[model samples]
Target: MDATQPELKRALGLLSLTLYGLGTIIGAGIYVLVGAVADRSGMSAPLAFLLAGVLAAFTGLSYAELGQRLPEAAGAAAYAREGFKSHWMGRIAGFLTLAVAMVAAASVARGGAGYLLTMIDIPLPIASGGVIVLFTVLACWGVKESVYAAGAMTVIEVGGLLAVIVIGGPALADLGVRLPDIWPADLNGWGGVMGGAFLAFFAFAGFENIVNMAEETQDVGRTLPRAVVLSIIISAVLYMLVILIAVLSVAPDLLAQSDAPLCLVVDCEKSTMAFFAPVALIATLNGVLIEIVLMARVAYGMARRGWLPKLLSDVHAGRRTPLKATLAVGAIVFALTSFVEFQVLAKATSAMLLLVFLVVNLALIRLKQVDPAPHLAFRVPNWAPVAGAFSSILLLGAEVLA
Candidate 1:
């Protein structure tokens, strides 16, 4: 191990960190999974999102508190190591965190490719594979550069969602008339709502990604926790409104049918599709970029901690990024995006994240017991982790049973 390895540069401020948080959290899930969620939950898709938001909130608090405490690169792994007093558990957590990034990126890449096909005539493998390559190069460029790119794309994606709300204005007017259509009519309908929430859980996956950026964030104890909470809250509100408009403007059945569901929100006309396909493509691309960055950082961090190979921790002195780790993570995702279909990848992602969330929540619980009153750490009430753990179990069990 090189004792004098260069550290990650701390160049991120509150706004940049917050935008990165939003970009990651809001990326893949809302753009791709919304239709899959609406298909099952029907008019009640908004409620399913709301429920998922609440579940994510409890876990988000756990993350925020832990970030304030550890603020390390492989965040969940650090939390596990500190809380459990075991190096192996930390390694397990680190690899699981890496897996989450890979699987999430794969699914996002696949979903983005579907939208890209609508505007350009290209083979599916080429579209998805090209995105992974382009973004991975951007990630290795530098932290500030990658984030600036991600932040710009985040603004455009947020604007795209607001546009959907405006375009679907007439549907909001009839939301009252549509209210009766939303509630579950029977056991089958309720089952769909439950199943839909499980899928929507994948939509809320990005909040935890912010914690991994802690090593590069200035004043991480203060900045990262705030970013985690703010991003989750803002994303939840946007997700509900957009899904509401989507279900109301078009039949859930029709939404379920299209690859680019949001384009179909305003009727999927040529002009609308022209505007939206690009925006949707940008949103998905931003997600892939962020996750690529995340996996590299985690690999570097784990290597630094001796959980992964020492080679991964070697930073590019000129670029000041994890060059080797970035390439390794990107190559894996480039291959993965071309394999599994989007929904299967999404479900697998959701299940894995739920388990990670479950373990993370438990970690916080154990950490609180070990150091009950750490000074200046962001503190959540004791019930937060408890609720987080139980809710994770509930969702995981529902997914298994259904």
Candidate 2:
């Protein structure tokens, strides 16, 4: 092994890093998974989302604490390694993080293709495959360039969601439309809400992606935690508003039926909200770009730590980017998109992420007890990590049992 390790450029500031986190958190899940959540939780979808946000907050705090302690790429894996004192455990956590990103990218690619079909007539494979290739090149170009592109798309997507809220504002004002029962009285009432929360949890999955870019962020110990927390808070607010408006604007059954749920929020005849299809396309592609960037960084970080083959750590001389790792991630994403259906890919991604969160929260708790950081810029209450770990385990159990 070479004595010296390659390093990623530290060019991202708080704004850029926060934007990256927002882009990642708001991407694929809201664009595609909202309808799926509606299907599971019916009128109670908003409540389910609220529960998911609370659950995510617990884990998010844990990540923020760990980010201050060990601001590294492959964040989850690094946490596991430091906490457990096992290189093998770190490798496993790192690979799981990579798997979640790849699966999620593929899932979003498939959903993006569906939205593309609504805008223009094209074969599904072509639409999905084209995005995978395009975003792969963008991700490989440079970190700053890729993140800038993602930030712009994030604005457009957020605008799209806001448009839905604005268009549905009148509908929300009308008290005649019956709101969904907050708590279902049916036999499967609580069970269904839990199932919905499990799905909604996937929407909040991308905040952790921020920590994986710690190596590429300026003042990571301070900047990363803020970005992680702020991004989650912002996304949670937007998600709740969108879900509430969606349930009120359109019937739950109708919302669940459409591939493009938000587009259906406005009156098709009265409003020219057809532009939303393109917005959805941008949102999903942005997600693909962010995930590809994250996967590459995880590979680069692991290889630098000698957990992966050293070749993956190779950087472009001029670009100073992880070119080899980027290409590797792109290839895997392309293959996954080609074969996997969106629903299966999404469930797999969510399940894997929940497991990763479970392990990550546990790592934080163990590290606090066994190898406390000497100088953490930010600290969480001692009970925070403990609650984070137990909540994550409970959520993971719910997913498995369901």
Candidate 3:
């Protein structure tokens, strides 16, 4: 290792990394997207989530294999460079990953502001701008601190979702919604479910961001793969449960109409679940924080490798964090939040990640063929990357056509 090269502190253990992954995975997506998916899939929203989870897992397995082989920040870009041996390809993949982070953070912040307005009377711009600034400072403060804070926020947000489940469970029996309705009927119904799954795919987007924190995590090879898979499974279960409760508690058409859909699930008649709104606000902020942390690491990794400006590689001597990259990411996120609407930004985020996932899966397949590591800590089946690449392309097409 070069002594002059900027280095991030390896302060994150397995627990912190797993919690961080869980926090990122269960963040703004479930809080904000359940209603939209319900609109498309009707009573079968849980099926959409389940199918989306399967799609996410396929690509996730590829990432798990790559993480073991090359545990580094700017994960997808690093994989592309090693697999394809093309600087331009690596650069594009890296920047695209960063773009996804920025757009996702901005979308979450915008949604957070909407949640905030339900409790307080403030301008959306002011609220959203305040979220970006606050999270940026937290991100620059220290890696461990930022992740721990996010973990706490994750607990609160998860509790909120659980509360909805418990509250809505009894209603399911009363509504007489048959269990079979959770699955769509025929080819036409399956098409609608698949479209909903494509939209629901956004809910599973944050798991890949975990790989970008490779440099900061303890025991990267041993820990990253486990954390990635565990976080996705946990988030998938929670999303399916929440979606089930949502469809059971309210009419799909009505759930689709509101910005804060979870609140409707908690109390559709009053629509004033005091705890749900604040919890959602926390979830959105947590999403922004995690995205900021991931983007900074990506920028730092790219800069350290000369793919980006060297200045961005600078680590704060005292904090041992990438302050420059953090601020740069913050600026971009703020600009996006200020200019773009939530749905547009969300779709852009999903679309960009689908492309990145395709490249990453292809990279993994290429690496397996050209540079087989017999002693990798983790390895997926030969067909895993192929399936991952195929699913990514299929989902990308579905998203575009939808």
**Per-residue C-alpha lDDT of model 1 across residues 282-353, encoded as one tens digit per residue:** 998889999999999999989989888889999999998999999999999999998899999999888888
Stretches of model 1 off by over 4 angstroms after superposition: none
TM-scores of the candidates in the order shown: 0.97, 0.96, 0.96
- lDDT digits (tens) for residues 1-402 of candidate 3: 247755778888778888899888886788888877887888888888898899899999999888878788878889898889999889999999998989989988886765787788988888888889999999999999999999899889889888888888786674454677766778777777877887788889988988888888888888999999899988888887788778877888888888888877776346556677888889877999999999998998899889889899888989999999999999989888888887777778778888999999999999999877888888899899899899888877776666
Best by TM-score: 1
Q: For model 1, how big is the CA root-mean-square deviation?
A: 1.3
Our model 3 lands, by Cα RMSD against the true structure, at 1.9
- Model 2 off-target regions past 4 Å? 1-6, 174-180, 268-271
Clashing pairs in 3: none
Write model 2 residue lDDT over 1-402, tens digit each, in one string: 354545778989999999999999887788777788899889888888898899889889999988878888778999999888889889889999999999998988887775777778878878778888998898888999999999999999889888877877776675345554655777587777888888888889899999888878998888989998999999998998888888877788887887877777765434476778888889888898999999999998899898888899888877878899999999999898888888788888878888888888888888888766667888887788778777777777877787
Residue 272 C-alpha lDDT in model 1: 40
Q: Backbone clash tally for model 3?
A: 0
Error of 3 at 344 (Å): 1.2
List candidate 3 segments past 4 Å from native.
172-177, 268-273
Q: Which pairs, if any, clash in model 2? A: none
Residue pairs whose backbone atoms clash in candidate 1: none
RMSD (Cα, Å) for all candidates, in order, is 1.3, 1.8, 1.9
